[model samples]
Target: MKLPYALAKRFVAGESLDQAVPKVADLNEHGIKVTLDLLGENVKDRKTADDTLQHYIELLEGIHAQNIDSSISIKLTMLGLDIDRDYCRNNLFELLDAAVKFNQFIRIDMEGTDYTQATIDLYKEAFKKYGKHVGIVIQAYLHRTKNDIADLAELGADVRLCKGAYNEPERLALQNMDAIREAYKEYLKVLLDKTVYPRIATHDNKLISWVKEYTQEKGIGKSRFEFQMLYGMRLNTCKALAAEGYNVRVYVPYGTMWFPYFTRRLKERKENIWFVLSTMFQK
Candidate 1:
């Protein structure tokens, strides 16, 4: 089925990099940084996986050639993690190599709990080799995050802290909203104290206020960290924060395979569901 263009516009940038670069330029013009994601994952064959790697290389080249102020995010499964571990590692290294040469950055995006450990492992190996040009994300809702943050912090890794979106059993994640919020607070503090450059990715006003207050109390400079949000969810808030002289980066995802990402964004807020459903019925 075709995705409704009106509904998809709120979350996805477009269906290809050609369509995405202009959007990136617009955001940059607004004084907000960006991370371009080529939306795809879970490939079933080596040929498709190799194609994903080539697309990423071209993406890096595109960013550099266009002089766009943005980084790129990649998923392991899209790069062959499911097909073969060794193949996945090689693919990651290939992207990292290109990123390093282009003087660009790559963010290793987290997936479900099943891929969590392997993703972290891949991040570690890549970081050890590529150094500061790469970063990884940690989900605050997971029970294992504190320890994970501690480990990554010791390596002085660049980390993006976000509340997870995947569905998992309570035994593995914090299910309650309040509990998750509190966990996010604690994780933010740890990231601030330990890591040099942590990206706080959230749309919650409470969390956003807390981050501001905590940074002020700690006397952390605005340049030391960044605030990250999705491409369309909190545009006003992101702009306000950027106006206040805070470094704000938007996660701009684009591509043809957008079902999983679009559905996940809709599930995060009931209003989003109602909006999409209402629009569909009205159409």
Candidate 2:
């Protein structure tokens, strides 16, 4: 008989904070920083959003108590974006307040295009009040990202750049892989030239090489910016970068609603599905 998806748990830490805490500690020991993400999105009710907020409050406490060098990232939908804007904003502030108490930063993870503008708006509001304690993500595949980077750089806000995983329409996103990679490189250059403390989040070896060369040519120190990669996908690459004395942070996601997140990761790279299947058959 085939094993259930539960048996294929190696990809995710688990559905609880307790399951993820040790993983964060281990990564810190390896000299890799972490950004802990509690996975879930498009919450349907205030009760659900409130519950998620409470969990994040507890996560903030746990991180401080463990003395682990990790930050938390959250999606607006998980905080009730679909229900009401004020509700979402208030919930976000609640988490931000908790983050402030712990002297930790909270990154607002970018979602699909529908929530992009609202997320930026909320990020700006929080940033105006508490500057470096918060950050936001921008997707390079979007047509407007170049301008967005310029605007974000103006605020001196921390930005995390990703290749975007949502299935967006061609009009709104780059449809070709080469074009997307070109856009990624271009946007990264713009960020490095314009912003401070930008996070280069990618798993592509070629792109990583380009970042290294471009930053070195510009005399940007490794401490001025950091490279970020997904938790389980590029361990060797992350380790190599850190060993070379560059700062690197892993995007560590955990929580119960992992199916959607895992599916998106699989869709990003078909080989990932093959890897999961192979692991399922192994001891």
**Candidate topping lDDT:** 1
Query: Per-residue lDDT tens digits of candidate 1, residues 1-283?
Result: 8865667766889988888889899989889999999998899899999999999999999899999999999899999999989999999999999998999899999999999999999999999999988899999999999899889988888999999989989999999988999999898788888889899999999899988998999999899899999987888898899999999999999998888998998989988787677766663
Clashes of each: 0, 0
Q: Give the TM-score of candidate 2.
A: 0.96
Q: Which regions in candidate 2 have their CA more than 4 angstroms from the true location?
A: 1-8
Model 1 poorest 10 in a row by lDDT: 274-283
Q: Write the per-residue lDDT of candidate 2 for residues 161-244, one digit (tens) a residue.
A: 998989999889998888888999887777777788889999988889988898899898988889999878888888889999
lDDT of each: 0.91, 0.88
Model 2 global lDDT (CA atoms, 0 to 1)? 0.88
Superposed Cα deviation of residue 16, candidate 2 (Å): 1.1
Considering only N, C-alpha and C atoms within 3 Å, which residue pairs clash in candidate 1?
none
